[model samples]
Target: MSTLPTLICLHGGFHGPGYWGPLVSLLADKGFRSITPHLLFGGTDKPIQSLEPVIEQVAKLVAEETSKGKDVVMINHSFGSFAGCSAIKGFTSKDPSKLSDQNSGKALGIITISGFFPEHEVSLAAMAAASRTARGAPDPATAPQLPFKPTEEGLLEYDGDPVHSFYNDLPLQEAQKWAAELENMSQFVFATGGGVYAGWMDVPVWYLLCEADNMMELPQQQSYVKKARDSGGDVTTREIDAGHSPMLSRPVEVAKFVQEAVASFSR
Candidate 1:
């Protein structure tokens, strides 16, 4: 079997796996394999009340591939990175001599696109609230009211225009098409804090920092990279003049970066 590490693409909140279609096809054309799973937190099912399901689902997918003797590279975008980091525990730093016959593959690397890297026990919601308050928006507890709207069904949807927040670089028609597909994610997702296991602390990491991201401003993204670095993480960052959804607006660029990350496992 060709032993190229599989690419596991994890989409952000409010997005479905379909959003990865363009990038997946591009990677496929280059002889790379990818799996894009729909995280239940972002699904239309009953609202997900905890982060464990998202983490468990991703961990299950990785375990399946690794069991097949195929190493995996996680490509985590936006809120997807939160689950990815927590889910990657125990999958890194494999010892071949101690490997079980059923599972030998290891995690090759992690790639985060405008990812959110919260401290241990810190929820994404708290981080956003603090960030907003620092910028003179509102009290830390009330800052969430500006950017997200709680649906009657208890889910959270982007309050502002998605085109402005997520797809400012795409053409108007394309942007609108994707905007209409946005779903209401579980409000509890941002409330869940990170676990003790954050794979970025141990695995090789590449961060695609979107310079023009309206949703996650460049400074905030830079701060994440810096935080990870300060904690002794091995992170390589590439700045792109694109919006938040580069996989949709700049597929070729995103594909090239993913390819670069996959190639690093060999070097």
Candidate 2:
């Protein structure tokens, strides 16, 4: 009997594991076992301030699941995609040959939903700078000013209107509820790069582009998709008419595509 792949979900900035609740529940009904880990940056109880530790944590989780003889399909949203890709890179680098061997460190594929695709050694800060430059805006020395303010400890807190930036398609009450549950995130995570290994090149990658995303503009998303495809990534793309937080606005459709990705691996 073929073992079904495990879906490992990583949420975006200011979001904990709870952010994946809707999609996880839907995937569960379809017989998919999904694990949503609260990243160190967004932990309600304890938040870590660095990116390396977060990547290590994710890699450790993947290793633990693969050691149990289960294939992993990493699903990432927004900034979480950077951590997910970094984790995959770390896992594959430990045993490059095992990437093709399903029994050892089994990583089936990666699904990036409205996520950033950073180039090798390119930090998120740099990507943000480039985005601003593309729009003919002045480049700032520090991290780009966000809609939210950072606390005295340098943790980012979302203070902007979620309805406009994230859950534009979601109901007002539902969007407000989720927005209120968001936690503080470490600024370090966004400033760091994916390092040497470009994991997307080695694994099958599916990019879900949210066409109506306000946070990540449509053109910016397309640029990332192009970068992945041009760099020899086995890329597949599907565009949805939704905002940045599709899990809140279109959970069923998001889960359907994720299920399709898992099915492709088995075939």
Candidate 3:
């Protein structure tokens, strides 16, 4: 039997690796192995003053897998997409359009679910600011801020109700249970774009656009997809009628989509 590339699952801010349990189990049942790293920026137990640690952790995991002759497919959600870029730098499959010396790394492709895409040298904060301006923020002082509130110890907490923000498609009881698992993420995460490299330009990219997502609205998600495609990145998108946490509300569909990517990689 041909070996499937290992799945490297990266979770978003305010979430731990446990959040990927449902999707991971489903993929495992289909004979695909997965690795979900517990990124430190999302942990409330420690202070994460920068994105360097998160990037280093993911890069180390990818390096280890490639060292063992195991190709990987990176799957990231929400803020995890930004970090994923830096981690897969030297490991991505070469882009035909971009001339580069990195041609032998074992990463086959990338998948982003309701994820952010950063332009080269443009920070997430800068992107957000540009978005605010495009929407005609009449006054900088009166414009709406990011959906996070300052918590103790320089951590940033989600300002919206978790149920409505992430798990609207899930049952009330189940949504509340998952919501409670969220943590106060590092404030430094969104402060800079240190981890935002254009790795997507180096590989085939699949984007799962959550139409019902409250956190990342559909327009914003579509805009990112368009931007990526215009920049000569090989990006394809699949629209799903689910909330931000599709892995919980629609694990079967998510699994099937991932399997589709795996099948394509084998070709």
Candidate 4:
């Protein structure tokens, strides 16, 4: 493979690839080729649902690119974590030989940011459950979250402003900027769950948990880290003081996490 690593950025629902634009540019400036696929689930005319198809598409892209000598790494945010895992399953299933080379250095190393990890038989942690069971819960009328879906005009959006509270550590202006840009967000991710999760990969994994995150909350992030660590892979954790969109609120921290994760491989 060529000597440089390719970073794939996956956005959650409602928003398209644009959510990863700033992060992609930052990585590009550092000499990394980044790819952000348009998951045509919410806004686009493309039929992008079902974890299987999405995983297949990611496998095809990884195979096509790695075949040409580019190492692949995926950095997933929120529900995009599921997508990254799905892709890994697809890649290994289609070409088991590629995975046989434990030190091939061409495998996917994922970094899930501000995401969740289920416990035991639980497939996912419902946002509603967090609210319903959460002691001292905020007034329901103040911050009500809607189930993800589409409206007229083919554009989609979601309710709940937990992100703001989650990201309270960030400067208000930055949070508002993200919120404005994120209004078109979708709820398709709400239905997409029970991913074809992989056991583990030889490649390194680093999860960036926003300490003040409100959407997934602190407890959920902890659960995810524990799962990854217990999953029998080279997993690591990086806790950030910012919110869900650390790239926007804290790009340098995110960039450094990426740099250090891929520093060992002979891409």
**Model 3 segments more than 4 A misplaced:** 95-105, 138-142
Task: Give each model's whole-structure lDDT.
Answer: 0.83, 0.79, 0.82, 0.62
Q: What is the C-alpha lDDT profile of model 2 across 142-261, one tens digit per residue?
A: 655677776777777787776688888888998888877778887667777644246677678888999999988888889888877887788899999999988878899999999888
Better of 2 and 3 by lDDT: 3
Better of 2 and 3 by TM-score: 3
Cα displacement (angstroms), candidate 4, residue 131, comes to 14
Residue pair clashes in candidate 1 = none
Instruction: Give the total clashing residue pairs for model 4.
Output: 6
Output candidate 2 Cα RMSD: 3.1
Clashes of each: 0, 0, 0, 6
Whole-structure CA lDDT of model 1? 0.83
The digit string of per-residue lDDT tens for model 3 on 181-216 reads: 898888877777765678888878889999999989
Error of 3 at 171 (Å): 0.3
Model 1 TM-score is 0.91
lDDT of 3: 0.82
Off by over 4 Å in 2: 44-47, 90-102, 131-145, 194-197
lDDT of 4 by residue, 15-78 (tens): 5567576677787888888889865444544344444556566667676666665568877887
